[model samples]
Target: MRTHRKVLVLFAALASALAGCSSGPNQPDTVAGQFADALNRDDIAAAAALTDDPTRAADSLNGLYDGLGKEVTFEVGSADRNSFTLAATWNLGPDGKNKWSYTTTGTANDTGDGWKVKWEPAAIAPGLDIGPLTYDPVYPKPARILDASGGELMTQQVVTLVNVSQGADTAAVAALIAPLAPGLSAQSLESDLAAAQGKPITAISLRAADIAPVQAALETTRGVTLAPQTRLLANDKSLASPTLSGLDDLWQKSTAAATGWAVRVPIPDGTKRLAGQDAQPTPDIATTLSIDLQHAAEDALTPIAEPAAIVALQPSTGNVLAVAQNAAADAQGPIALTGLYPPGSTFKTVTVSAALQEGSVTPDTVLPCPGVANIEGRRIPNDDNFDLGQVPLHTAFARSCNTTMGGLAVKLPADALTNAATQLGLGIDYVTPGLTTVTGKVPPAATPAQRVESGIGQGQVTASPFGMALVAASLARGSVPAPALVKEQPGVADKTPEPLPPNVDDQVKSMMRETVTGGTATSLRDIPGLLGKTGTAEYIDDKHAHGWFVGVDGDLAFAVFISDAGSSGPAVEAAGRMLRMQR
Candidate 1:
C-alpha cells in the first residue's frame, strides 16, 4: 500500500508539469487573435492603434493589402498571453492563378482599455511578387513632318479668313479673259476677291481691263450700277492665314480644323481661333535648310537632270547637317537616314577593307584590270571602258576597277564577305525616333557571283545615303558612334562599337586618299584631303543610271545619291559644291 501511494504521487507531479508546458508564458496566437478580431470588425484605425509602431504596422498592412484587388484572410495559428503567430492567404489578382502566403509575428501591448496586438517585424513567405499593372504605355499617333534629325517638326494649327467666296464658274470666266488674266487663273482671282469681301460672292465676270472704272464708280457711289444691266462693288481684301481645305484626308489627321472657313488650331500660343476669325498672332517655323546650298545643288545636277538626294552628316556625331532632294522630290520618298539605293562602285571601300582583313590583298597587291572579268559564269565590267592594267591595289581601288574587285571576290569565302558586310552595318533594322527609315537589303548566301556584285556594290545589295555616310564616318573616326538627334546628357558615353578591323580601316583611308588625289573623285581636287568614291550603276530598260559619291573630310562625312540621272558633269558638280561648303 505504501509503494502504490508513491507511484500515484509521482504521476500527479508529471501531469502538473505537462499542463504548465502546454500553457507556456505568452504565445503568438494570443496576439494574432486580437489583431484578427480588430480587422474583422472593419476598424482599420483600431487595428492600427493595436501596434506599438503604428506607422510601420500601417505601412506593412497597406503593402500587403492596399492594391491586392481581393480579400485577404489572417489565421491565428498559435497564441499565448503576450504573443501570437499568424498565417495569411490572399487571392493573387484578377487572373486568380497566383496565390500568396505570409507568416507574421506580433507582440501584446498594454493599452488603457486592455491587452492589444502590436505587430513585430514579420517574416513574409514566398516574398512579394508583382507584374505589369494597368498602367502600361500606349504608342502615340504618327506625325506628318519629321525633321532631318527624325524629330517631330510641325504641329497642326488653324488659319482663319473673314470672307471666302463660293464663286461661280471662275475658271470659265478666266478662260474667256485669257489675255486679261495673263498668268492668273480665273478661280484664283475669284477666290482672292471672295476672301477680300466679308461675305461670300457668286461670280466676277468682267475682264481685268474692265475693273478700274467700276472700282472708281463703286467708291463714288458706295455701290454702283453699271451699263448693260451689270452691278459693281469695291473688293475687300481681308485674308486669314489658317485656311482649312474641308478634305476628309486633310482634316482627319490634322489637329487643326479642315473647313474651307477658318477653324481652331492648337498652336504653341495658348489662344484658339474660331472659324472665320483671325489669328491673334501668326505662327512661323524656322527650318535648318540652307536655301543657298539647296539651289547650288540643284544647279549642279541640272546637266543630268536626275532624281537625287544629298545628305551631309557631322562625323563625330551623326547629325544630318543638310539634305537636298533633287527635282523628283515627291518620288524620292521620306528624307530618312536609311533611304535605300544601290551603293554602286562606292562599295569598293568595303571590298578593300575585306581584302586587307583577309590578308588576301595588300596596298601593293598587283591586280589585272582588263575592263571586264568572267567570274562564276558571270561577266563583270568596269565603268565606261576604264581599265587599270597591272596596277597596285590602291591604284585599282582609286580607279574603281570592277574586274580587279571581281578577281579578289572569287578568292574570298562567301561567308567572309557577308561577315564583313554585316560589320559595315548591313542587314539590320534602323529606327528613327520620329520618322520612317528604310534598311537596305543584302543576300544571305552571297554566292561568288553575288559576292562579286556586292564587292562592286551591285547585285542584291543596296544602301542609303545615311548608311553610306555612316561608312564614311566609321572610316573617319576608326570607330562608329551611335547616331543621335538629341544631345546626350552628361556622363553618358556613346556605346556603339567599331565595325571594322583597324588595319582594314587604315587601308581604306589610304585608298580613299588616292581617290581624292587622282581617282574617279578627282573633281573634288580643289578641296584638299577630300577622300571619296564615285559610283555609276546601270539599270535595265534604258533607264538612266544611278550616280553616287560618298566622302569624308577631317571630321565630316556625307553621301550624295543622284537617281535616274546620267553620270557625267552634273554628278561631279554636285559633289564639288557639297565639299566646298564643308571646307
Candidate 2:
C-alpha cells in the first residue's frame, strides 16, 4: 500500500511539472517576433494591435520606410517575462541581398490579462523620427566644356538670382534689381511684381560679375532677396554665347546620369558641389574648337548685326577648328553647319573642274568672256556687267565671269555638275554624333538653262558653310579629307562616285589663287599664298545678296557667309581677319 501511494505521488508531481512547463507566461520575444512578421507583410493593423500606442507606432514605421517601403525580419536575441531584445534586418526590396541590420527592443507586461507590447519609433529603426523623411537630390559640379586646347570654355561659378515675395514691398524689389542687372528691365519687374499672385520665386538670374559693382547697394535694398546659386557660365559671355549653347547641350547629354545624386540635405548656397554620388563621374567634353579662335571669330562678327557664319577647319585632317555665328544667325538655329545657301560663283570651282576633267576646257583654253552669254534664250551677265573679254578659262574663273560659266555649262552633260559637286564633298548626308550639319544639294539639271544656273551655283545647287569649307579643303589637300568634330567620333565621308582627273585638282587650286591675286578677290591680294574665290549671290528676289568667301592659307581652310551683304568685300575682309588671328 505504501509503494502504490508513493508511485501515485510521483506521477502527480510529474504531471503538475509538465503542465507548469507547457503553460508558460506570455513572452515579450513572442510578441516581438509576431510584430516583425506583421511589419514584413505590411499588415499595419495587426502590427499596431500588438503595440502600446497603435497609431503613433504605425505612423513612425510608415515614415521610416518612405516610398514602397521594404522588407522586415527579426531574430529574438534574449527574452524575459518583462522585456526582450531583437535584431531586425530591413531590405529595400524582398531581396535579402540588400539589407540594413539594426538592433531594437520591446517590452511586454501582463496586467491580469494577455501581455501587451510597448512600441516606439526605435522599434522600427534606431533614432527614427516622427516627421516625413525626404531625400534631397544633389548634383555634381557641371563638367567643363573644354576647347581643342583643353582650355575651359564653360565652367562653374556663383550666380545671383533676385527673388520677389508678394508680401514684401513690390516697388522696392524692382528698383533694387534694375541697376544690378540692366538686362532685366525695371519696368518688366514692376509689372511682374504687380502681377505676382503667389509666394517668393526667382524673378531674374544674373552672373556674379553682372552685379558685382552694385552688390553692396543691392544687398541693402529691401523687398528683393538675393539667392546665390551655383551654375555653369562661359568664361567670356560675349565670345561664346551662341557656340557655348551647342557645347552646353553636348555636356548635358554626357553628364545626365551623374546628376541623379540624392543626398541627406538640400543644395545649399556656396555649395560648389554635392558630396553624395549617384552614378559615374561626369566625363569632361573635349572638342576640336579653340576658345581663343572662337573669341576672335566672335569679335569679328560683333560689329556686323546681320546673319553671318564662319567655319574654320584644319585642311590636313578636316577637323573643325571653330564654328561661330552672329546672334542673328544663331537665332535662326545652327546655320553655320546646316543652313542651305546658293554656292553662287563659288560653284565655278566645281564647274570649271568638271569642264577641265572632261577635255572640254583647259587652264589655257580660251573661252569667250562676253558681257552677256545667251544660254537657252536666257541672258547671263557678269557682276556689274563687266566682262573679262576673250581670256583663258582660268582667267574667266579668276574674274568670276558669270557669262563664261553659264556658257560652259551649255556643252556639259546634266549629271556632270552633280557628279563633280559630289566629288568635291557636297550633295551627301552625314551621321556624325554631336554634329548638326548638311553636306549640300546638287540635283542633276533638266533644262539647258538649268545647267547654266547650276554651273554658277545658283539654280538648284545649295551648300552650307560646311560644304564650302570642304571645297576649299579638297583643293588644299588634293583629295577631300574626312571631316571630324569629335576626335574619335565614328563616321565615314561619302566617296566620290568617280575619281577626278589627277591634274584637275592642281588646275583648280591655281585658278583659285588667280582670283585672290589678279581677279575679283583683290581685297585678299596682300595675304601671301592666299588661295580663294569670292561670291555675291543675289537672293530674296534679287533685292539683296549674300556675300561669300571660301579661302585656304597653309593648313587652314574656311568659309564666311554674310546675309544681305551688298558685295563680297565684307566676307573677304572677315576671312582676312580670321587668317591674321590664326596661330
Among the numbered candidates, top TM-score falls to 2
Which window of ten consecutive residues has the lowest lDDT sum in model 2? Answer: 1-10
TM-score of each: 0.54, 0.75
State the lDDT of candidate 2 residue by residue for 122-217, as single tens digits. 555554533343333446557886778888777878998877766555456556566655656655665666766665667778887777865786
Error of 2 at 76 (Å): 21
State the lDDT of candidate 1 residue by residue for 426-451, as single tens digits. 44444422223343566643577778
Q: What lDDT does each candidate get?
A: 0.55, 0.73
**Model 2: CA > 4 A from native:** 1-54, 57-133, 136-142, 165-184, 192-203, 259-279, 490-500
TM-score of 2: 0.75
